[model samples]
Target: MASEANPRQGRPSMTSAMRSSSFIKEHQQYRPPSKPENHYGIDTVVEDLQASKISSPRQISPFNGVPSAENPPTIVESGVSHELSHPNCTSAPGTKYDKLVATLFYKSTSPRVSNTVHSPVRVPSPTRGQSPKPHPSDSEFPPNMSPSSSIDTFPLEPPASEPEPLDHLYGSHISPMCITSFLHLMSTFPLPPGTADLNSAHRCLKLDATHDYHPTVVELTMSPAPSLDYLSLEDLRKHELIYRFEREWNTDVVLRSDTLWRRYPRLVVFDMDSTLITQEVIDLLAATIQDPPDLGARVADITHRAMLGELEFDGAFRERVKLLKGLPASIFTELRPVLDVTNGVVPLLRALKKLGVKTAVLSGGFLPLTSWLSGELGLDYSHANEVVIDETTGRLTGEVKGRIVGKERKRELLIEIAEKEGIALEQVVAVGDGANDLLMMDAAGLGVAWNAKPRVQMEAGARLNGDSLLDLLYLFGFSDEDIQTLIA
Candidate 1:
């Protein structure tokens, strides 16, 4: 009865404890074994080891699942033993146990299985001018780090590109033309090799608007400037330029103090008919005689010969006059309105006037026509052959009144004018386009061939193939604005 009472007393308390907690009842629901079995058996361990051996040439390292070299696993010592405790699997820190674990882990994790030397993984180096990237091995943020809060520690960014300069571009402001593009042009343009390189023909000089100093390229020598005129057309072909030389237009040649214009600023003498005015004056008179074909052709032939130094000018004038003996005296007036002046004539003459330079005309063409042009162009001096007329009949008398204005007369006139103006010969500039004009060209300080005959172009100091007499302003170091002011 005492034992029964004691057991019965404990039953009620046990029932109370059981009612307080239902965990033991839930545990009874699972029917698994009392002791946990090795999920990875000896067969599984042996199979894993064989697979690793067959795949990799490298010897397996022993010690948990850590590789023999780098990239060691972050093994948890507490869990590794329990996980690797099978009969055949590696569990201890001994060589045999570690080799089994190393083999298993290496086979599962390594990209390749080889004993051969492997190149280390390459990290990309930063590109030039770019900021370097942060490495993955750098200190990691704490697990509690917020991305927004980490903005203060951000890596550097690449810099932005710089803006291009605009002041040097065209239309930014109206600047002087760059003359480099025209430097190597023309028969007598001064062109020496740039630094002894053949490719140097392309090199051009840049000069300032003031025209007061050295060229950006090598300074041009006056002595070598005329060398191009001596080149045979074939030889000149060897100095072929790929393009014209100019930045827009420059004053390199004119800026050189040695240039004829810069060294001496004096007189500028011009031819009357073909040069100052754009016609052969005698041809106009011959045109009025088309009624007599023989007479007109004979006069034109004589005129051509006189210009080419083929016939004496005095003889040609008398013979051509005999052919024009019966022409109307109104011929000059009839042809006056139809005259065509060369391009840029007004601008060039205006520039010359502003400079206070003396101007003259030495012409084999008629005095009546040249004298008329002298007054119109504001000439300082004028000399040309005169035609005598029978006053009663008002017709040409087949005679010249004074000496014929041939090549010698033209040269003499240039010298006389330069002397009258108290100027030296080197201070004189003569420009013409005929064989007869060569004599005056040789006498002047600087002689330019303006759209002249081939022989005249080849012999003259410089040649202007372009029709613009405004180009003459460039030779005197005049800027576009300076020329415009002269015109205005």
Candidate 2:
């Protein structure tokens, strides 16, 4: 009875053992083995495991369905008996692994392989005692690396050790092939240091070195020469000659000195009609004549022709004076007060006098007009044709005294004035409008064709296109600031 009671007491213990075994078996079916301890000899495998953890996909391994010898997959030592035991377990023939191993062996003499079941293995370094270093061209890594990535990795190892030397020689950082290529390039081109060739090569590389490197490339390619038609010797010489001529012509026309106006001329000779006074004296005189204004038009036509050198001065003067045969000389006295001077004449003449220049009026009109102008303007001298009137009748005299003061006469007078004043010919300045004035203009040092005829404009040295006569002060080296005080 006591023995039967003891059996009952042990029943619970037996039941507990059975339940624990069942639980342990179920856990083993699902759970991975615990990580192994790293002994000194086992450190390489542990390191590989750490490396694999870093490289492996985040999730469980895809080949986990294959059973492994160890409870948890472990890195197997390469060339060990256990490694060959799984020879059939390796990737089949013609697989990516086979190709990879073949490429490694071809590139390296004694390529190492890792036997880790689940860890990624780095293909080993080239054999320790190899003959020649494997060319990167022969490596499978280059083919496997994407074109963009390969290009990025080019210049893997420059032939030279330092970057600065390459920069000094080539003006840019060195390329992987640069040191090897430099000697060859120098041999081919053989340019002197610091020459344009060296500079050009450096500049070309600086601009184009960013390009992708090709494995097959043996040398750097130079850009093609521009398709320009170079000038021949004759063409170049002709162009140079033409350029020189044009430059000289341009220089001649430009102002000799910027301060031309400050150094005013010693003498300033002005044209009377239309230049000094607002209206033409002949035209004014013609307006005073009778017989229906037609005679006035005819006289004006004759005056224009004479002034323009189209008609002889003596002939035009005699013809016009003949038409005025019956007119009284008192007309001049009446016209004197009404004769209009230009806007800036009085001030300009005052400024000229202040500067010690001899100012004179040389006109083709009669003394009746010019005499009044000279007295009114306080001119130093005046020249003009004299009108002859019958002393007794005070009317019908058809003669002009002395030679007609036309173009040639104007030139003669300019010369005479320069000589009389004891001034150099270069010191004289002539200003006028008519074609007749061209002769005087040519004779004088500085000829200003003031609002001149086309013929005069073509012949004169300079023209006064502006409205104010004060601008002539600019030609005499007067500054705008100086003129302000003078004007005031």
Candidate 3:
């Protein structure tokens, strides 16, 4: 299955997977291997025959080179029942064993055919009670659609094979990695003091501050032998943190995990707009023109609906673009002043860079903003939609030229960027907020929903509801001293 982690598992590379398919094709017209003289002694063959408890092999088999009516060819034994005895059995020459072996050989010996690879129908999953679309990240697609389409939705079941930790694969015990997040009260406001009580006497958690940033980076640790199963323990702890503090602080909860970063050297990717930045670029653009002041509110509403999954993102994007038609391209520069860069963007990114980690931005927002963000923050790569402009008029055309890098495209971009840098998909960490970011998030080694919507918060691997993006630095295992030294 494509979702199988290291889909290339057992095989060496992508080429090997193709060869497996080729091998299946070649075996369609099967041929038996040439039988040679006795390899194993006749006694061995007789022993195997006797084990089957067949009174006489010839009576039911070839039966003097003719099919027997009493015991016909339809008497087939599935491999699950008993594997066919190999033809290599042999014994001493002229012995009773030799006689028995020859008698068995004279009868018909059948070979089993494997039907798994050859079956055309996909067996319905017994557990997938209600059929939901297989998430694009999972690489399961409908008959007509290709894997390239980026429709972001939750997979009925997350593909487990791709991740080692989920399978509890780290030298005998579960990985000792914990997701620690420092919460911020608002997008611009830094994490308030004492909201995250590191000294809490909770049975499932232990807190230790690793940084001196406003909210203070804290490690949310779980015991080696957690009360809950390893797979569900971290998530349960995360929910507990959110439930305890999210309402008091006015931000969405997302968890940042350093253990994952330390364990696997990865390329970290982030989504722009409401994620790395405080404001939505499209809504910001909508607010630029004051001809109808409510235009900003209208566009903002649309953006909110889209992010909340209440409206289709693609169509809503088009509608937003249409509303911004004839807007000057200079808005990009003008908006920079009003663009509220999220707290911790600089420190978090700087820490990653100092750690020799590569970073990129894959945004659903436009490239002009994304490109400028990459330049401003020193990101390694940036991918986003190109807003078509009437160059002659220097105004927006309200059209997206080329491919709109939607959810699936985000996943593809993550792969392309990682591969270009010589990293695998499992060595990538994706951060985002909106529904569209889910595909790439799910595809990444770790997906942190940073102040995301409810849908994303629930589905993402980790959630950091707090506003401070710098807490991400702490989550990646960097102490305040480490970050300051690296940036310095």
Candidate 4:
């Protein structure tokens, strides 16, 4: 009767019968415990009933309160697929919740349960392709070392949220507020302390203080130590001058005492005619004669020519003296008080004497005049051609007794002084203003042309254009202080 109930119904029923086999078997194998009757709402039953109408071959549910076979509720996996298809059914495999549970339970705790859990197999992370980047603080250390040690071994503390007071960091103690205040003070009023001198508290502050905010600590160990004593004004002046000249000339040539005295001369030879004395002694002598103009010019020309090295010393001397054959010897006595010394000669001679340097008068002019100056200035020596005058007649015979002291004799005299004094040739200094003095100037170690002739200036080692002979002290490394002592 059941098989023959409806042949058309049997066809649909057969397919339903096959599909329901697994569900029915599962239900029978694991029978669900009884639930309360009110658990299944009427609306839920109606919904199941309608679904059965749409689907073929539905049957009665065994338990009314339980979920129907055709319309079971979905149970979504937590943190996995959130879509709800059926309330009573579990979520699909490979969901996020399944992975999380697998990680916490199976992978992490399996070691305790099994001794050979194969090292608790790791699930290759989805983020495995990218390497982890280091933190900013870790950059200080090598890659092989742990970053923790670097943080532990850092010399300075980390920047604080609230800065400390200035006094706390520098004056006395350490605190965040102190450090901040100190940094503020440094930034506002920064000064270099390293340049300060030792023993001076201000200098010590400058040396030890770090006014720079960026790097708070100053290293004073490398700074130079200050001298115990300061230099005097005179020494300071000399140092300054030396520094200036050295910079200007780009040379280390210093004005040293030993160099000056050694390089300069001991004997300064002077020519007495137009050089030492203002007027030409020969012209003055010629004035005493009757034919003053003719004889004076002639003698002047001879003196001039001989001084310029144009004529031989003896020849010029003989020629000039011959013209004065009738001149009175008393003319020298008359002109003795009238002769004038050059502007700077007196002071120069005095200074030279004080310096222990010798002065010599070498002249083609008469000895009478040279001898007077020699005695007045305390000159070491004097050489000149003598005018032979008849004592009773008080007249000149016009003959020079010795060799005329001209350019050759001037040079000869300079050499004689150097040889006689046992001084080095470099220790002889010759000063003259005439062309005739060139040979003597060149003979000495250092030749000075004092307000010299243009020709002499070119040949001399140094030239002094000014009338003040005090400048000559410079040639010997005599500073203003030394000059004061010499003049005094």
Top candidate on TM-score is 3
What C-alpha lDDT do the candidate models reach, one value each?
0.57, 0.56, 0.60, 0.54
10 residues in a row with least lDDT, candidate 3: 98-107
Give candidates' CA RMSD values in order.
Answer: 35.9, 37.7, 32.1, 43.3
For all predicted structures, in order, the TM-scores are: 0.50, 0.47, 0.52, 0.45
Query: What's the candidate order when arranged by decreasing lDDT?
Result: 3, 1, 2, 4
**lDDT, candidate 4, 215-294, per-residue tens:** 11111111112221343222322444333322222212211122335434578887787667777787777666665557
Task: Give the C-alpha miss distance for residue 230 in model 1, angstroms.
Answer: 13
State the local distance difference test value for candidate 1. 0.57
Q: Between candidates 1 and 3, which one is better according to TM-score? A: 3
Total clashes, candidate 1?
A: 15
After superposition, candidate 4 runs with Cα above 4 Å error: 1-264
Worst 10 residues of 2 by lDDT: 98-107
Pick by lDDT: 2 or 3, better one: 3
lDDT of model 3 at residue 439? Answer: 90
Candidate 2 residue-wise lDDT, 296-390, digit = tens = 89988888877676887767777888887777888888898888887678888888887788988889888877987898899898999997888
Candidate 4: worst 10 consecutive residues by lDDT?
A: 97-106
Output the TM-score of candidate 3.
0.52
Report the number of clashing residue pairs per model.
15, 11, 17, 20
